[model samples]
Structure formats: C-alpha cells, structure tokens
Target: MPARYFTLEEANALLPELEPVMAELLARRAKVVRQRHKIAPILDDPHGDMGGAAATEMALDFVRITELVEQVQAFGCLLKDLNTGLLDFLSERDGREVYLCWRYGEPRIEYYHELHTGFTGRQRY
Candidate 1:
C-alpha cells in the first residue's frame, strides 16, 4: 500500500504534536533508569534480605521497566524516521517555482503537484 503523505504545512504542524510524545518517551526512559538504580542497591546489599517477596517485587518492577523502555525506544525511532523522511521543498521542472511535499510514508510526492515552491504544493499525496 502507498504510504500516507502530509503536506509541508501539515508536517510542520505535526511537530508540535510529536514534541510532546518524544518528551514523554524520554521521561519514561529516565524513570526506568532511576528505578533500575534503586533496585540495584537493594540487590547488592549483603546484610539485607534479598531473596524473599521483596526480591520478587523488584524483579517484576524490572520487567515492567524493561518493557516500557523498549516501547519508548521504538517510539523515538519512529519519530526520527518520520522527521527524516519528510521533504521540505522541491524545485519544479520550470525552475520558476517550487513544490512542497511530505513523503513520511507515501509511495511518492510526484502525484502532488504544487503551484509555487515550498509548502504551497497541491495536496495530491
């Protein structure tokens, strides 16, 4: 299937939405790291009980954190791909004007013809 493409304006508008999602993902990663540090000291304490119910709870927490970290990483990667995949502008054949198209996941922007250069391209994606 052809990928869904966004206009330059549409893509630019999406940055606002993407930033928050990226921040949240980063925050989750930080939380996971902090949780890991907290659990590590507990595991290394030689004089404390480390093999009882508390250990099981810590293990479960670790598993949950790992899953969250993976999810956040995946989101970050997708954002990176989208950011890089988008096109800012392209010169038209006449050279008198340019067209803007975003191929975030579309087959191509050839179908979307623009009148001038920049984000004013037609929404043919």
Candidate 2:
C-alpha cells in the first residue's frame, strides 16, 4: 500500500483509538518479557521442553503483538519501536516527505523528523 500522509489534526484525531492499542501492545510485551524470564533457565537446558506452558503463553503473546502492530499499521502509521510504542505518520514538510512522530503516553502529536532520521531526530513542528 502507498503511504498515507496525515495532517496534524488527522493524526491527532486517531489518538483516542491509537492509545488503547498501544497500551494493549505494551502490556502484552511485558507479559512476553516476564514469561521469557520465567522460562530462561529451561531454555538453556538442551533437552528441556522449554517449560511448555510458559512457552506456549509466550508464543501466544507474540502472535497478539503482531496483531496489535498490524492494527496500528492499518491506521496508516508506521510502528517504529515496539519497546517504546513509537509511531510515525507520513506527511509532507517544506515540499519534502517527513514523519510526524508520536510516542505512547503523549497527549498528542507534537513532533516530526526527517525521513533518514528516526526518533532521535525528532523536532518540534
């Protein structure tokens, strides 16, 4: 699919929907991390089943993560960082393509960055 450029208001409008998904994504990610830690010792054992129950839960968490990510992308923004819940909505700036950057917990979109740069390059717009 082609990139969908978003005006500032359009991007902000999606926040209500986007916030819950991000929250869910973050929660699932935390589960995966905790489950992995619980199963870490088993993972080192060559003959271990890797703690079957915990492993299955972790696998399911991964699937849910993928679905949550796809859901966000379907809204026409790029999911940049799963760990930080970062996203970038494509937009034009000064006649050139740029990203309208957003992160989890922010009240609204307040920053942007050049295409070649990522979150670290975020700038107030």
Best by lDDT: 2
TM-score of each: 0.36, 0.93
Error of 1 at 22 (Å): 1.9
Local accuracy by lDDT, each model? 0.47, 0.93
Model 2, range 44-111, lDDT digits (tens) per residue? 99999967888888888899999999999899999999899999999998999999999999999999
The local lDDT score (0 to 100) that residue 69 gets in candidate 2 is: 91
Query: Which pairs of residues have clashing backbones in candidate 2?
Result: none
Measured with C-alpha atoms, the lDDT of residue 41 in candidate 2 is: 96
Candidate 2 ranges with C-alpha deviation above 4 Å: 46-49
Give per-residue CA lDDT, model 1, range 16-104, as digits (tens): 54444445444544555666676677678897776466567656755764564455343322222222343334333444333444444
Which 10 consecutive residues of model 1 have the lowest summed lDDT? 75-84
RMSD of 1: 11.2
